[model samples]
Each structure stands twice: as C-alpha cells, then as structure tokens.
Target chain A: MTTNDFLPAAAPVARLIQALHKLPGVGAKTAQRLTYYLVRMPEEEARALAEAIIAVKEQIILCSLCQNLTEQDPCPICTDPTRDRTTICVLEEPLDVLAIERTRCYAGLYHVLHGVISPMNGIGAEELKIRELLMRLNGGTVQELVLATNPNLEGEATAMYIHRLVSPLVPKITRLARGLPVGGDLEYADLITLTRAFQGRQAL
Target chain B: MTKPRTINTEAIVLRAAELGEADRLLTLLTPAHGKLHATARGVRKTTSKLGGHLDLLTRSALTLSYGNQGTGLATVTGAEALDSFMSLKADLRALSKALYLGELADTFHPLEAPNPPAYTSFLEALQALESPADHDLVLRSFELRLLDLCGFLPQLARCVQCEEPVLPGGHFLSPAAGGVLCPACKPSYGDALPISVDALKVVRYLAANSLSSSLLVNVRLPLHRELAALMSSLLRYTLERELRSTAFLRAIAQQWPKAEDVPSRTA
Candidate 1:
C-alpha cells in the first residue's frame, strides 16, 4: 500500500512512522503498526523506551582497549582478570563477541575491528581498528592471536591482511574453522563450506 | 495474472550489500544483462544455499525470477558457482587486484544492457589473476581492454592533440586529453604527466595483445610504477572520482614485496 494509506494523518504520528520505517527490516506496514502501538502504550512505558534510546546513544562509548561498545573506557571484558590476556580473539563487530560468549567456550580477550575490509564499500584496513589491535599486540603480553572474522570473502581478506602483519609478533595465530553449521543437513551445506570442512577435518 | 518471468544466466557478483535481515542486495554483472540488482532472499542466514555461490567476485550460474511486479528487482531462485577463483582469493594481493578489476567492470558496465565482450574480458582477467601470471600485466591489460570496450581507450600511439604519431623517446600523458601527447602538444596541456618510453611501449603492448601475450612482456618495477600511475590517472579522469579499491591495492603493494620478474617470452 501507499504511504498515505499507512501513515497517520497527524504530523507527529506520520513522522514517527517514517522514522520507524527507516529501521532495518521495518516496512511501511510494520512501521505503522509500531507507531500505533507506541501511541496506545502507557505514557510512563513510552517515556522509558525513549529514555533508554537516549541513554544508549549518550552513554555508550567504544572501549578504549577492545574497541567494543561499552559504558566504560576499557570494557569489563578487557579489564576482567579471569580473561586469558595472552590470547586475543579478533572479530569484525561487537555483536560477534556476544555470539561467541553465548557458547561459554573460550576465556580470552577480544578486539573488535568494528568492520571488515570491504573495498566495494570503500572500507579498507585503515577504516578498521587494526592499528589499535596492533598497538595492543605490541605490549608483548599477547602470545596468541585468534582471527575470528566471518567466513565471508571480506572477512577472509581482513583476516589474511592481519595475519600477514601480526604473524611475526604473535607466537601463534589461528583462524576459526569453517564448515557446515550445527544441526544443518549435509545435503544442504554449500560446496565451499563442505570443502573447508573436509580440509579441516580431525580424527576422533 | 501473468506468470512470473524466469531466466537463467551466468553472472559475476560485482558487489553485495546487506538487505533486511537474512537477505542480501547483490549487484551482478552478466554477459547478457550487463549489470543487475537482484535480491537474494535469506542469503545472509547460516543455512542459505546461495551464500557460498554469491560471494563478491564469484562467477555463478543464477536462476533469477522477476516476480515482485513493480520493483524491477529480480529474486535469485537458484545459484551455483561457475568459478570461485579460489587461488586468487587465497592470496591477499591477488584478491585485492581482482576486486579492483571487478569494480572497474561494474563502473564501465551499465545496468540492464548486454556487454558480452566486456563481460568476457572481465571473466578472463579474473582467471588470469587466479593463475601464476604477472599480476601487474593482468591488471594493465584488463584496464586497457575494458577502457577500449567502453570507448574510453586512451591514445597511446598518437597524440590526442596534434594527431601526430608518438615518437618513442619520452612523452607526456594527459588524462584530460584522453591520451599521450607529442612533444609539440605537451606544452599545450598543463595537466600532462611525463611518461617514460618504456612505460609507453608496455602500455601499447598491453593494449594490443591478449592477456596471455601481455604477460610475456616483462615489466620491471620502475616501468610498472609508471604504467600504474598513468593508468590510475586516466581512470580517475574518466570516472571523475578515485576508485576505492585503488588505495587498498596500493596499501597491499606496499605491504607485500613485488613478485619476481617472469622471463620474457621468446616468440
């Protein structure tokens, strides 16, 4: 349907609809639905939501050490004494750090590059936090550098570039293994992923 | 209601951007379609079958269905990799160069138009990059050939201004004038950059020969620098903007040592 059909006649309501529509995955219908929902919500609850958005925008800052978004300079993860300071897992974004943490598998520090090397988008290694990561490595306390960049082409390129640069300094460097996802059918796995899985296969 | 139209074509993934969650907006270059913007639904999810085949710089056979009616965007129904250029992607230097070539092709090619020759040239260039051939020569040849295909080929043998045949000692290249300038014409063009005779000969050779034959002409580091500078200037002038990949390629060059020279071909 057209914008006129979905957007409220009121200027403020229409404006809210347009703003909500700009959010990723929000269509005109979804935006209208959310806008109307907000309009019906209790004033206190709506105020809380607005205030939370403001708090996030104003209070959050990139962690000085890991470059992940945090309320503090060196985030809790970076300052955590339980973390293995000798190993650092490099990732493309802060969301990735959360994903890895969900597994409760590793206990190492993380350095978020904030983005991968994507030349098509005009983003290069310089646009990333690679320099900061290198500076952290130069402290000479880190013994292992785990490249946890995505399995995509841009991610691979970023990882390779970092590996080339940091190989000499770090005692060990490793890449996250690529393969079929857990619970995914073998027949559904893509050829590249399957190939990598076979290449990285381990014996029981 | 009319049935949806579907066409299967071989396409190279020129660029990809994230669309609403679990989907991707891809800019593809096809021999028949030239350039296309298609939505690959669910391509971002872990289970997407299209994800591996539709990566940037990959040539894949794609089945596209135009069913969104007014959107003018096609949805990818099926995809299989034709050539992933795995060897090229394995090396950071080669991968950067290949992406640069893909960007150039995307820039020169227009959407929804057929450009089989340009498409073929691009595919061949990627294949050449995947091989152990000279990276510099492959790039130069691709640039020259693509410019020729797009009718932007710079004048190398003759002066762009005086129309006199260029003498083989030293000349100036004016990207604005769209080619090399003879000694007499050099004074007229203030933007003309000095070009060595060796660099001129190499460019001319690359422009004339196929990618394989072009690789036979061994380019020393100094000459390669001259050629690269001249080509970069010409491209910047043509596009009226600097390509993003150029800086990345330059950074890659500075980080990695140059590959050893290949032996000059005898025939």
Candidate 2:
C-alpha cells in the first residue's frame, strides 16, 4: 500500500513525505520511512536539515560566467586565478562539470550547455544555453573549446552542431576521445565502439 | 507477491529521457504494442550493455518485464539494435526530418493500442528516410501516408462540408472543417486555404502510392508549396501541437538555402 493510504498523516508530516517522494528514486515506502525517521530525529538535527534546505534554496544561483549552480554569481571557480583561461571545456550538464572537476587534471574554465541536443526528445539547440557559451567567446581570449559531451549519438550530434555554430568564432575545436573501455574485452565490444577504438588508435 | 511477466518484441526508440541517476525512460514504438514506455536500468552509465541499442532512432529487439510494484512502468531487461539508420544519423538535415517523423508517429499513435497500420507506416517511413532523397518531400509523403494509415485522412475526395464530389480543379482546404471545400462552402470558412487541383492530386498520389513511387513522382515548386502547406495544416489540426523539429529544420534551411529551397524535382 502507498504511504498516503496511512489515513491522512498529520498535515506537516504528510507534506514532508510528499516533498521527500518528489526527489528522484524515492518511492512511497522510502518517503514514509524517511518521514518517520525525521520525526524520531533530535529537534536540532531536524532543524539543521530544514535550515540547510532553506539556505540552498535561498543562496544557490547559476554563476553568470559558467552557468553552474553556486552560492555566488561568479562562483569560486570563475574567480580563481590559478585555472587556465586560454581553453574552455564545454559540457551538457552541471553534473558533467562536477565529474570533470573531480578528475583534478584539467584546470581550464568551463561552459555548461545544460543539455544536449536530442530531437527525439524534442530538445534542440534553442533550448540549451549555447548562446551563453558563444557570448563567452566574444573577447578572443579563449583559444580552444573542448567538447566533453557523452560518447553517444545525441551527444555526438550536439557536439557536431555546436562545432559548426561556433567554429567561425573560435580558433580550434576538440572532442572528447572515444574508444574501448579500459577493462573490457575486445571480443565483446560493439561495432561502433570497435570502429571508433580502431580509428582513434594512438601510437606508442 | 508473484513477479510480473516478461515479454519480447521488436521496436524502435522514439525518445529517451534520463531517469533516477543511471537509468533511462525509453519510449519505444513497437509493432504489437504501438507506443511503449519502459525504464532501461543503468543505461546512462557507460558500462551498461544496453546503452548503445536503446539510443534515439535506433531499432532494437527488447525484452521487457512489467513492474510488479504497480508503477505502470516496464523495465527493459535486454535489447539489441536491429537497424541503426547510420547515414541518417550522420547528416544533420536528414536526422532532423527523421526525428520529426518519429515525433509525429509518437504523437499521432496512441499508447498501449495495437495498431498494425500505424506501426507499419512508421516502419516504412523510417526505411524511406534512410535513403538519400528530397528530405522535405519524403517527410511530407510520410506525414500524409501516416495520417492516411491512422484513419485521419482528410476528406479530400469530395467536399467535407456537403459530401459533394469535388471536381479536379481549384478548391479550399479547411483545417477546422476537416478537408477540401467547394466554392459554395469555401466562403463560409474564410480561413480555408486555397488548394490547386494539381496539389491535391499530388498529395492524394503520395498518400495512396508506395514510398518508392511517391519518390518517382515530380512535383513542381508551386505544387510542392501547396502540398506542404495543406499537409502541415492537416497535421496541426490532427495533433493540435507544434512539431519541435520544425524550428531546427528551419534554422538549417535558412543557413543552407539551396538544398532546402524547393524548385522542381529532378525526374
């Protein structure tokens, strides 16, 4: 039975349950369990949780430069002087920006498109933050654009499309290398992956 | 609780939406089930084996098990790509039109309904799109044929107003009124667009003939515009929503003028 079937949980508790269930992957059972857990939690801890949610809602905004969510308009990364400014890495989502940041190798600025082009899903170039990326190129400061979209059909298509649109404005454009996985067997690789791996083979 | 049943079917990926963190919600158009929406667990992860086969516009044989949790969502257990439509994927313009056709099929075809005619229409439309040809003409023919197959064929054979036989001449096409109107009924629907006899004839021909024969038929620039306008109006009335791909296609058409600027068809 659904958590709602528990006969109209107290208004506040029911609201909290609904809010929890709205989060991704949180089903009815998990929502009810979490609500009860919160009820049992110390008053200070629960207040801290509510306060953290409120703070995030109040403080978080997209950085004016990279479009990444942050408390400040310019964000810490955008204000950092140690990062390379000559190159910019473009990605489909803010999550990708985080993924790349975790690698700790790349030190360039980033431009988040917020989404890739997917015609089947009715998402197009107009829907993305591509114009913001283009506007960042106006100063003739950034020399290279590293397209880091996923290695799938929609991602490839999006990269290619942005490349065409921005090629005239930039000096060089590069794409994330596509090849076979590190631990995968060659025998099991699909035709497209195998072909890309073969075509992109590097010399020792 | 007893586990839900699992079944297999051949299908094409019409749309894929990200779900949870690593899974995808796939809208698959199938022959037996019409339009199906299922969750492919872990598909967004690179390590997932089913990722490649479930991409948008790719056809695959899918094994799906109904969710016993009463979520009304099925889980894709396994899948294999049957047709990749590689060339269409490579070209931007072709890809746009192909995806437009997919969106149209998804919109016009209802969920959980087994409509073989609409299903086969989709199959043939994708096949027709795979070949190199006039992308717009191919799309128009696909739209008209899909409309015909879906039983939304506008009453073109006669006056939709009075059911009078329309002669092979000038007539008005009305979206709200549903089809071609004679001069007598034309004045009533002021919004009715003028449709030349030749344009209506070509549209009828495209709808009735096989994709190959439709490709062979030559439509002059003027006739082509009329046909395109008529079909677009018919589609807007039937679906009542704008096709998303049209904007992207319009952008490309504006950039590459000659390829999209329709004149007369060769042969």
Q: Judging by lDDT against the true structure, name the best candidate.
A: 1
Q: Candidate 1 DockQ score?
A: 0.41
After aligning candidate 2 to the native by TM-score, how far in Å is the CA of B87 from where it should be?
A: 2.3
Ten-residue segment with the worst summed lDDT in candidate 2 chain A? A184-193
**Which one wins on DockQ?**
1
Candidate 1 residue-wise lDDT, A17-55, digit = tens: 888998888888789899999999999999999999999
- B45-158, model 2: which lDDT tens digit per residue? 777777877888888889998855534788998887778776677666666677788888888887878787777777777787767566667878888888787788888888
Q: Each candidate's lDDT (Cα)?
A: 0.86, 0.80
What's model 2's overall lDDT? 0.80
Provide candidate 1's TM-score on chain A. 0.93
For every model in order, what is the number of clashing pairs? 0, 0
Q: Worst ten-residue run, lDDT, model 1 chain A? A: A1-10
lDDT score of residue A8 within candidate 1: 37
Model 1 alpha-carbon drift over 4 Å, by segment: A1-10, A27-33, B1-4, B68-71, B259-267
